[model samples]
Target: MIRTSLASAPLRVLAADATPVFREGLRAVIDRTVGLEWAGGTDHADAIRRGVRTIGPRVVVLDSAVDPTCTLIRDLVEINPELMVAVLFRDHDRSPASVRVAQSSGARCLLSRDTEASVMVRALLQAHQTGRYVDPRLTMVLSRPWQSASACDAGVLLTARQRQILALVAQGMSEPDIARHLDLGAATVSSHMKETRRRLGARDRAHAVALAYHVGVLPLRPALVAQRGISPVRPAHTD
Candidate 1:
């Protein structure tokens, strides 16, 4: 069972953002927070991994602009499943695809870069305590009902192998990397990707992932919804 209580000590927080200014700014806010500790910040994924090993923070706030596919987020969580990941996305960068990728990769929270300090703090606390926190803004996107039955039907056309490839794609894996990981040929991986896109009628890989979430091929965890204190929005009726 997952532990629900906050640690007795201040929750140690680390940040990874490519921008030096933004990284330090987050570090300052974390340090100033009452029950949080600023473990450190880094400007790259490698450094972030090194920092994680060195500081052992309970939560890591990642700038999605730096790692848009959330591959780093997935890698970090794989290293330590208990480590809460809070992804920060720039305003224009927010989309169903990015949100789905972060969620699928085990991110505990998603917040905007310009989110209020108070809200960030709450997100941090909630994520650490409850194991999930989706931004209220993105909840609507996640809850949107399929516009047509064909969209839902499209989901069933994907083979299990196709689904596996798409899941990795959502996590931001390159075709070659995915090929290597799955022990398949790179050309075969490409073929599956193409077929998956065709089956979903997705314009691109990202669109495919967004559609996956929409059609229930990639499900949003119940804890994500329960912790947010909101019900899933009902689908609009099409007469």
Candidate 2:
């Protein structure tokens, strides 16, 4: 039997894919899986909404290529925050913009269509429990240095102290806590934070952490990749 830590009933899963053959194949996989129940599959956004309302699935697997912006994913989460959304994207669609859209829209996980069935199931299960999952491949992609010719070029680098401070911040440490841990005064910590933000062009601590991860400064946390991109579309606000 498939060993699972899931409580109570099997996890209910719904899939939305524009291609009929692909949708049926995914449904078949879910049906054969031990701890998953194939709620239903749909090719249209309207039908997906109806299926969620009728089937009351705990997880929805969405095709990012079909719904690039993940508007439906956002709508579903808005309706039920407890519902986990796992997005499947084509290899070509795996751009920084796509990642940002998936993150900002509150998608629990992002996967490639070629992802193995077992891995996909694991991602779904992890997303249900932790509310987030970043594919290791995506982590590799995000951790690479940027090649874009933007204001913040690939040559931009963080000092050793800045990297250390960012790593602590990524671990959810407060400025004061980081000061105590590093044997530095609050003022010194605050000054370092300010300079970090300026150098990374981050709007706040969370953005700084995201930038650090994107630039391969801070290690990637498989459970939680910052939803926002290095330079998010919207103005960054304090989290």
Model 1 TM: 0.62
- In model 1, the Cα lDDT at residue 56 comes to 93
Question: Highest lDDT among the candidates is held by which one?
Answer: 1
Q: In angstroms, how far off is 33's CA in candidate 1?
A: 0.8
Q: Mark the regions of model 1 whose C-alpha exceeds 4 Å error after superposition.
A: 1-7, 146-239
* Alpha carbon lDDT of each predicted model: 0.74, 0.73
- Candidate 1: pairs in clash: none
Poorest 10 consecutive residues of model 2 by lDDT? 146-155
Clashes of 1: 0
Q: Per-residue lDDT tens digits of candidate 1, residues 85-187?
A: 9998776556554565577767889887888877888888998888889888777655544323433443445788998999898788999999999999999
Tens-digit lDDT string for candidate 2 (99-160): 65566677879888889878888888888888788898876654544323221432246667
